[model samples]
Target: MGFILLINFTQQGDSDDPQSAAVEQFVIGENKVILTMNIDQQVTIERAGQGWRLLPAQRLSNQLIEQMMRTWQQVQGQVLDIEIDRSQQSGLFISMVLADQPNIQLFTLYLLAEQVVVHNHQLDRYFSLPLPMFNQLIPTGLLINQS
Candidate 1:
């Protein structure tokens, strides 16, 4: 007998918002994956051929990629009334591009000392997602093979 393993990572949010649309590609901030404190090595993950593959030839587990996509598709949070500090470093940057349109919608998630904030450029709104759930969305410990 074969068993199917299903995983759900959907979060409730405004469906009418363009930022809430499906994410076809994503470019995660460098600090989220790298441990050397350098913010220049940004890693981009997108659809390659038939499956997902990280840029620069990094080996990533299929499960990890699927989880990330699920988070992007089902991420929901409350819009914060507080102002965002632009000086603060961003934890993640998610971008979505439509096939018919030439513009790319950008979303930035800022990790603060006490809370996490996500800024949807398309909607021009600030959202606060649970710290634990945000952490799960960020991919880590990916193998970077340079051989």
Candidate 2:
């Protein structure tokens, strides 16, 4: 399956809104998958072993994307394509896919201040998160898609 890259943005007052991203559809074909990113700055991505992960809003920094793209470009064996949704200004839903084979799940990493937050997408929806025992809960990985 192919891959798609989506980048969604939030309106001025909608910065705190959670309904800013959605997954429309993903079609896996003979050697590629077609995806749509109708959102402004939001993107949908699937890591090899990871089923699907929703990347919403402009929470992703330009530097991060550039770095990722550079690394992705150097790859030559299997091809991972990307599509972006660009219909809505802030809350657009797009679609994407990853390599068909299974592998270590792709993870999204966020850097906040002096801390780092890394976790799978599935457990991100829990209400009462199991905050680390650390005395300070660092503001790492802004969950822009949440309330």
Q: Estimate each model's TM-score.
A: 0.60, 0.20
Looking at model 2, report the run of 10 residues with the lowest lDDT sum. 126-135
Q: State how far residue 96 of model 1 sits from its true place (Å).
A: 3.2
Least lDDT summed over 10 consecutive residues: which range in candidate 1? 30-39
RMSD each, Å: 13.8, 20.1
Q: How well is each residue in 3-119 modelled by candidate 1, as lDDT tens digits? A: 222222122244355564433223222112211111124655666555566665556677777687656656667666576766656455565543343566567767776666777
Candidate 1's C-alpha runs over 4 A off are 1-41, 88-91, 98-101, 142-147
Overall local distance difference test of candidate 1? 0.55
Q: Give the per-residue lDDT of model 2 (tens digit) for 51-143.
A: 223355455554454443333223121111222222321221222233453322222333234332332232232111123311121112423
lDDT of 1 at 79: 64
